[model samples]
Target chain A: MNRFKKGHISVAVVCAVLGFMISLQFRISMEQKASLPYQRLEELSSRLLDVERERDKLQEKLSALEEAAEKGEANSLSDQKASEILRQRAGLVAMEGPGVIVLIDDSRLKSKAGDNQNLYIIHDDDLLRVVNELRAAGAEVISINGQRIIATSEIRCAGPTLSVNNVRSAPPYEIHAIGDAATLENALKMRGGVMETLAVWGIQLEIQASENVEVPAYKGTTQYQYAKPAGGGAS
Target chain B: MISAVCGLIIGLVLGAFCPLIIPVAYSKLFSVALLACLDSVFGGYRSVLEDKFDNTIFISGFFTNALLAAFLVYVGDHLSIDLYYVALLTFGFRIFQNLAIIRRYFLKKH
Candidate 1:
């Protein structure tokens, strides 16, 4: 019995120590990953813009060279510039402002399954249209469920749930943003816009305006090595 | 592919970051339940990963705890509290969780 007691106490101590280490490691693993400096995003966005501009110049020169050659003139790069212009906008530099997050959730919203007159199920397109109008209305930054809306963000239907930028997000969808809320709301609520369409469809739009909204750091890093935009001519 | 099981995967994900709300006991249970549902959805991937859960009754223990923290964090918004300290939750749950595990295994065996 004495030996057994000793073994048990030692084991307990070991377990306790192990648990503590686990706890500490857990704390470290999920700690806010040294917030990759806010300025870094801005800087990276700038570099993207710079690359696009350089591409634009190159495109213009090529167009000029081609055009001049066609006409057998000295300036031949103008034609390439035309093609570059056709490429329109490129990179993740395009964004909008401190904005509003309109959470449309099932919470507090009564829905009658059988009642034909009062059905309130929000759909994929409902959000899509809202995001589309925000883009159109010049929302500087927008995110549904903490997922930022970079230029290539995708919001789509994943069964009953909606995925913002490929991450599944639920009702009471938190839209994080940094933009002019009044203008962004106006863009969304503009006539025949996403808001009106949702209203017409009878979906509730919960708009919360905030001055300082910290959009969650984007989860996955973006990779774009091959799909460079055409030498920027159009924009 | 497996993450698509039920709506649980999303729920687990959402639950994983669910803010801790209500009392600690209730919050902890809520997280566990969501995680259990998540495990059931995943066909016990969480538990199967463990070598005998005698020391861990619930599958995805960390995930359950994290979900509770998530609930607390979001709830903090309404309550005007800052509950983002995940380490506290982790440490707090350890003793109780271990006791529960021991009791469960021994009591059942005895």
Candidate 2:
């Protein structure tokens, strides 16, 4: 009777292990199913690469045209002026001048004596506030984490990461703004300004002035289907 | 059989409630180990029916078989080979063979 009991107990233990494993596998697979958008991300990234290549080709063409116009070729002054306006409106021109580069990163210090661990990480709103301050300080062109800021650009959070212009960006966000470097730096560091507020939240921020800060051209397409030039004539 | 059912029920409940999550990278190892465990359980059942079961051998074989199967999968992954299928096929065949023996034993008794 004792021998039978021991054998029964051993079999029972093995069955328990098998059941646990099967259930664990089921849960993991369910989690994987819920997080299967990674495949969609892969497809979107490939599409983005293709779009970037096309943008590069178009940029090269625009630069060639600009050079031809400067050399007094078959380009008129009015045509050049129109192209400049269009380029600026479309955010197609790379900006460079004396400007400020603001680096915002998650705090290196570990959270202590608090349940609010989010205080150590830079949020989307933190970036938005900094960008707003830069714009108020008269920044002409700005790019955050290599994504150019356009009129239609969006800054938001996606899960554990921040999305700027629909691209996932982690902490240590490098914000390059083309404007007066001193003014931008002062605006960020002003009394009760963005820097002070971020400091209170334990986010690390550094503002540096540079003689030349380059902001990349917007890579996204601009489609204007609904709004035409008012009065139907090109001014 | 009743004890096995009770233990399996308890394990399923624990697994469902446990918040522990296995990383995706080691999921293959878990799957191979599960197969090896299943194979071991069937072998143990067959031995018990044959009156040749040893507790020490059963426990040791259970752990060793699972570890060895998981190791085989890990090695195959690093070596860029599909050795998991080999483990799966062999263990899976053995499970069926053991089940057949158990079925024949029950049929003879009836």
Candidate 3:
């Protein structure tokens, strides 16, 4: 009986530990499912697609170079034109066209007692959502407070300020997009869109359509170390 | 058996209400460790049924198995190799073996 008692007690203790580990793991996986880090994975996969497209472009450029060599013509003028167009597409060159200017600022409404204060602040997510909406509406070029939004650009929060392409800026964020002005404005003002959600929090948002909206050139370095063009150019 | 079931129930409740929040990044490691713990519990239970249970062995095996599984996951992540699958398959096989033996013993008794 005493021997049975010893074995039984040890088994119980082990079972308790097993139960604890199971529940803890369940909680962690549940939390992961509910969180926003999945967006980071989506961003990285999109970046991979962008690199693949760049690889395709380089392949086309290689074919063009070979044809120029066969013709024995100095294609420097056309090469210059090709590079200029590439730079403009890469957001390295400043752009100007008819589009809409959006201004979003933190809410001025005072938070009631026991309310979470973060709801009233303009977050990086808010800016990202607006930029995504504009892109979906076929915006050709976009910038935030003169900082161009390129493929590799990032909008991240850093304490009281937000960093777009590593340049820190605060609200009221001035977002300029050069596309069809009416389309961009309509995208922002769509019912149940990002603007409506922000309005619920009393965030200040204003949109103005104009004949000319100038978006500045990207100032950051466009160098990449790990990702290489597949198949054709170099290794 | 009753004590074991009660202990498991108590432990589950305690864990559910606990405020510890492990980051999602390390959830894979924790999951492997949990599997190891589960295997240990089943092994201990089987030993008890077979009259071969040892307190020192059961307790040490419980800690060592869980720690080693977690360590394997950590090393696998750093080396970019999926080594936890090894621990997973081994522990998984042992758990089923123990469960089969326990089921046979209960069937014979009835």
lDDT (CA) for every model shown?
Answer: 0.56, 0.89, 0.89
Models 1 onward score TM values of: 0.35, 0.47, 0.45
Best prediction by lDDT: 3
Per-prediction CA RMSD (Å): 22.0, 16.8, 17.0
DockQ winner among the candidates? 2
* Superposed model 2: Cα runs more than 4 Å off: A1-4, A37-235
> What DockQ does each prediction reach against the true complex?
0.02, 0.47, 0.45
List the pairs of residues colliding in candidate 2. none
Best by TM-score: 2
Error in Å for residue A137 of model 2: 23
Q: For model 3, how does the per-residue alpha-carbon lDDT over A182-203 read when each residue is reduced to its tens digit?
A: 9889998999998999999999
The alpha-carbon lDDT assigned to residue B58 of candidate 1 equals 34
Q: Give one clash count per candidate, in the order shown.
A: 32, 0, 0
Candidate 1 positional error at A214, Å: 2.4
Error of 1 at A73 (Å): 36
Q: Which DockQ value does candidate 2 get?
A: 0.47
TM-score of model 2 (CA atoms):
0.47
